[model samples]
Target: MGRTSKIVTGGLLVCALVAISIPVGKEVVPGLFPQDQSSTVTTPAAQLPPAALSQVASVSELSPDAPLPDAAALSDQLKEALKYDGAGTVSVYVSDVLTGEELFSADGWTARTPASNQKLLTAGAALATLGPQTRFTTRAVTGSQPNQIVLQAGGDVMLGRDDSKPNEIMGHAGIATLAKKTAESLAGAPGPYTLAIDDTMFTGSTLNPYWPTEDVAAGEIAPIYPMALFGARYVAGELTGPRPHDAPVEVAEAFAVALERAGVETIGIITRSKTPEGATELGSVQSATVDEQTQYMMQWSDNYVAEVLGRMVARKLGEPVTNEGAVYAVRKSVRNLGLPMDTIWTVDNSGLSVSNRVSPAQLVQYLNILLKNPASSAGQELKGLPIAGLTGSLSDRYIEPPSWEAAGVVRAKTGTLNLVTALSGYVVNSDGRLLSFAMIGNGLTDGPAPLRTVFDNAATVLAKS
Candidate 1:
């Protein structure tokens, strides 16, 4: 081509670049580009070349201006951002906390495994349906005789190690309370009486159906029998071992011994029993409110607690106590709030099974429902979540500056089991707007490494501009 034509083309190209500059900074594109010949970006104080090597200063006193991409504009584009890493599909949803604005989403409605994050749903379901003042009821019933009583399972997950005064037994002292109650009830029977328990809160499915049968028996995943009569041994923040097989029996023995120490003579055998018809109520204990329950469940990323909470959903909704029943019931609970919830598939309420899937969009919907319906039992439950960086799984997050309020200011639930890592929570952004977000990753080959920078960048963006 002719030199004159080349010069003319170059000038037009520069003009076109200037026009592009008007909207350049909308969304942060990739790295940097040259702003002028022989120099990068020029500023008021410094005169330099296209770039430098030492500290890599921006030469421009203006701190260098590439272009400003609208955060609100980029918000919608943030969904599936982790997809760039070529890992499993990642979905994100962020909303304005105050204005109810759905800032962004990518396949947000597409269901995906939520991992431990599912505990949030269980916790939320429990808190919303049940009141903060609500407590689980653990009761003692008499089936045959006064001295011969039945220690019935009443779905008390926090039942502790005592056996006296079943109604007000300290959670840790529950087993002992049971023992005490046994002694009091036997009150000098003619023959040696026995203590049998009825764990029928969940009848159809006794174990975590989603867990491998071998693993279900005693590992981190035990059969979620409706009898948390004894506290599950939570280790490394996960259920590592099952309570002894003779757990309840041991509790009965303690009660009997305590009574004998109190001068009551009795010989009895404590064992598991069937839930019989027309069982009578002898004494009982109450569970904490739904809010308190959620707090406990989420802070520790508990699975058994989630399972029990699922059972509670079944009980309250009058559904069957199977995995399917609980999922349907929870879905119904969400729908009852008048939100769209067709995109979720809850295989297990605890999210332990890879079969479980939830869309980032759906979580945001859940959050919106809660924010809009403050009087709602569910919203109240959401508030029970531990403060980020302060409680629950998020206590250690966002330890650095320039990071979003992912730690203390955010109240979110984290889900991680094996190769998956997830985060879902609420944050009040700098603009004083409430933002609900979900960051979920699956098939993380290097575990969660591929998604760390993505999460940090997103959080930084949300917190900054």
Candidate 2:
């Protein structure tokens, strides 16, 4: 058989084997080992919290038609693989998607800093609240003055500066196109007109106080604005750098330049104002669908995109478009999912804020919901996840043992910071049964390298189980 065939055949064989022997209530799954012998393994050091144990118990009574690997053996392996005697605490949660049973858990309810793993929640929240087909629009409307024009930001944070290059999202809808359309609409009635920018879609501070001072200065994050060119940076043509503090004003200036080149003249200083209610729209550019943008955010762990989507969610939910508003919106979205909101405490949509906290169990539960209905909006967001050793953030991972076996089998989200490391996603086990799992580490004095190894090895075990 070819490599693909072999893999498929092996997967089917394991599924068939497991499907044939159902275990009695609370009894060990039959056929894991000989009927007469038993195996022992280490238990996780951290005790499962009451909340997590309750969730586990909810699935304990499930009686699958097929047998599964010995829960004790899996638990032992996970315990051994996840044990890290470093400064930080570690949490692990794993569940069998087919049987709805908790296979292993340790401190699963303990909240920890998630790093980029927070994007998973943000992505889900956006899909749940904004719908899959939602798109942002940037518009040019008539200003209060006859010769003046208002460039209204419609939450297209990634809008391109010009029309030279095309992009799937913002770049496709170029500023130059809008400028040409605006000039045409004026019909030579304008020359050296003053321009203004409307950025009131978001109502609060651009910079989050919780964000580190150095990150803003170093360009790790730009001022979150609704209408900006190239994600708020000067990426016209080939140039890209940190965006100015007054990004919206700068974008208005650039739009003025584009208007002039398109036969419209602009004069005087550009200013900020709210677009009049009855203003006429000269031109508009739209972004890609929310689903595609979410995929991009998840694949690259883009902070700017995440923040933009968060604000979008806030707007959809009738909340202010600020850091606090984003948190409230996400909370509303999660609450609407019928999941408890106590597990999540977020200061900002992008996990860049160290103040964010989320539990391992919460992450796994969210994944389980998505897995239960892969066709649902929540499930569609999973398309953005990086595949182990194949694409996205995981492209460089799983190339070596003991993670090699999971190279193509594991699809997950990775999170890392100074001392935090997290991994959450799905794995098709050796039995071809899908599983949802999450692991997180905090206060890791040893850094993330060793914890990453532990997490990868744990994933490999699940894939090969």
Candidate 3:
């Protein structure tokens, strides 16, 4: 997955309003069943409340006692909320972070498509295996031909072309700076040179086969490459468009363009090859720290950063640096952390693939493990989740009625596919006790917007419990 920016729309509120007055139409429903399944059965649509409400949902109004509401009580409220959606199967799991006592569970152990929630696993694995301070290096070395330079790929996917302006996500390693240094090394020597790209750091397919082919054009993913600039490609300051087939070539071209702009003559076509033996080091740039990169991945659901981190973990484990290798390494790392392995399977780190399966228990338990040791590198992953109504994907969410109480109080990683919606994170209950939860909605026929309210309202219920 290449780093691609997404457009958040206001359609969610519109759908919520429509759902409140009239039942969701069959035509508007997304198929809930997995694509591999045979049929798509339409389920009765759930009714949502009107978007306009007199009173704003507020957490300041509700408070609970020391012994929090028991499991039976919590289950009743959550079930009632989920039943209102009437779109798909709902999985819920919640527990006390301090006592480790289960507060509620509804099909929590069943495997379901996780969407972006899978990034939680990837983030944990990267931090646990590679540590927080790990940095990727991109270097320019002497090429085989005189005046020819080789750009070595060292897993810096967010490499930028401009140094004056920092990238929106990856703020380090500017290609302009590298070009300046490279030009300094060749100060008295050459007139024009050809640039060669060395992208062998990653050893497999540039694109994951399991991903939907159409997602590329849809701007949901880009070619996975070890070396890319500005998230592979950005147009008119917007991160959109299909990934170029030869991403490394495009990177090399950008490097060449940078070199030329820096008063260096770049002649001949850009080629892909390894740096020659004993080649002198010209210049280098290091990527943003792994932790920073992970935070960006979670913040924007940037698939590219997530995939890159997965490969970094794979490299740390001495496994292949391919997509399959990343998946295997991430799962292994999760298991090594003593988290549940069964009922959890993933083919890609970004959760762009529908084949990815995870259980609510796995997600909730993973977070709890990290929350218990917040001082450790792996534990830092919890800080990456989007805060309700504040940052990242949740910037515009949690502002609606009913679920509004969770605003500024709940922090969670969200997941959404056509017919799936998932929320997993920690919330401070009315008792002031921190709790962890994982909720997933699959087979959702009416789409995620209406169901999103259900999930948000459920979390609000927990916050007030």
Ranking by TM-score: 3, 2, 1
Candidate 1 wrongly placed segments (more than 4 Å): 1-86, 145-147, 163-173, 185-191, 212-218, 229-231, 234-269, 275-282, 401-406, 449-457
Question: Rank order by lDDT, top first?
Answer: 3, 2, 1
Report backbone clashes per prediction. Answer: 44, 2, 1
Candidate 3 lDDT, tens digit per residue, 1-465? 111111112323343233222321211111111111231132111111223332222222223344566678888888876675375888889988766778888898889999999999999999889988788889999988888899999988887777723444553788888889999998998578888888888888878999888776687788888888766665323445666666678768777888887888988878888878999999998888787788778877888889988998999899999999999999999998879787788999999888998899888888878766665678766657776665687766776666665555577898887788999998766555667899988888888888888888899888667
Identify the leading candidate in terms of lDDT. 3
What are the per-residue Cα lDDT tens digits for candidate 2 across 1-465?
246534433443342233222222211111121111231131111111122222221123333443576799999898888777778889999988766688888998789898889888889889889988787888899988777789998877667677623446547567887888888888857366888888889878888998888777777678888877666667742222566677777678778889989888788888887898799999887877787778777876778778989999999988988889987898789777756777578888878888899888888888877766655676667667776665567766776656755665567888877788999997655453567899999888889889998999999888667
What lDDT would candidate 2 get against the real structure? 0.73
Q: Model 3 — TM-score against the truth?
A: 0.84
Error of 1 at 390 (Å): 1.2
